[model samples]
Target: MTWPLQRLTAPDPATYSPRQQAIHDQIASGPRGGVRGPLAVWLHRPELAARAQDLGRYCRYDSSLDQRLSELAILVTGRVFGSEYEWQIHKGHALKAGLEPAIIEAIRCNRRPDFADVETEVVHDVAFAAHRTRDLDDALYARAREVLGEQRLVDLVGLLGYYTLISLTINIFRVPPLDGGAAELSDV
Candidate 1:
């Protein structure tokens, strides 16, 4: 499905104030090139923007979970939430992390993907649990703990919460899904 581009009414970046430019620069160097809609909103509020950038940095760069699991959790959450923007952005990252196309497609369709191994399964379970409940049952907790240590497990939960927040914001704002100029959601 094509998504519309939600054009910002803000002034052009070339004419931005020094503070705005700084925020823009921080986003540019951060994950997803800081061009994401949510981050763009944060930029309009400088203090919040800085804090958001720092959180983004920690989640994207300093998280204890490895890249593959991180991407898995993100993709699963995006898929479950039907946040097309998030799905569009992370699908490529998921692919690059060696996730199979079939698996990605499965996730996009909200199915239980066939994981290559146990680690991916753990990530998937955690994501499912996060969406399905606030508390993890004993079985789920044990499996996660067995696969990922306490620290990494906590980080995994944090990642889930972070992306869940992102999904909520983007969906609430109706952030347009990415379009390569073919068909716009606005036209649909």
Candidate 2:
């Protein structure tokens, strides 16, 4: 299937306004190593880019949930939104963080993944439910709270919320995956 032309490409760095240059440099210097994808698209609004990237840094790096759990939540968010760029970007991170490959595939195909522990399962459940329903019902919320504890649960929700914004940006702008390959999310 063909994708629509990307609505916004990164502005030429040499032509960047001072504000853009500053934000671009900051983003490039951070853990992301470089700016591309949704972050790049956001560079058009330097203030938005700067603020969002700061939140993104916290969500991606310093959240209370460990890398494995964070990546799991990110994958679920990407899949639920059918954000191809988001999915392809984080699939590698999820694997490197030690989430099972089968679980990743299951999420891509919209199937129930068999998680090995209650923590993983609870994180998945919270992400899936929150995305599908737009709000958590009482029991699942209680379960997630109980399983993830207060701080982790809060961070999990914040992480999910952050990725949701990322997904929206990717989808709205028709952002293609960075790999520039055929789309990987079939059932999404």
**Top-scoring candidate (TM-score):** 2
- Model 1: per-residue Cα lDDT over 1-188, one tens digit each: 44445544334677777998888887787556645666776566777777767876787679997787788899888877777777777777888888778877777666788877988888888888888887789998998999988998888888888888788867776666655423211221
User: Candidate 2 — which residues are off by over 4 angstroms?
Assistant: none
In the range 95-118, model 2's lDDT, one tens digit per residue, is 999999999999998999998899
Tell me, what's the RMSD of every candidate? 3.5, 1.1
The count of residue-pair clashes in candidate 1 stands at 0
Error of 1 at 168 (Å): 1.5
lDDT of each: 0.75, 0.92
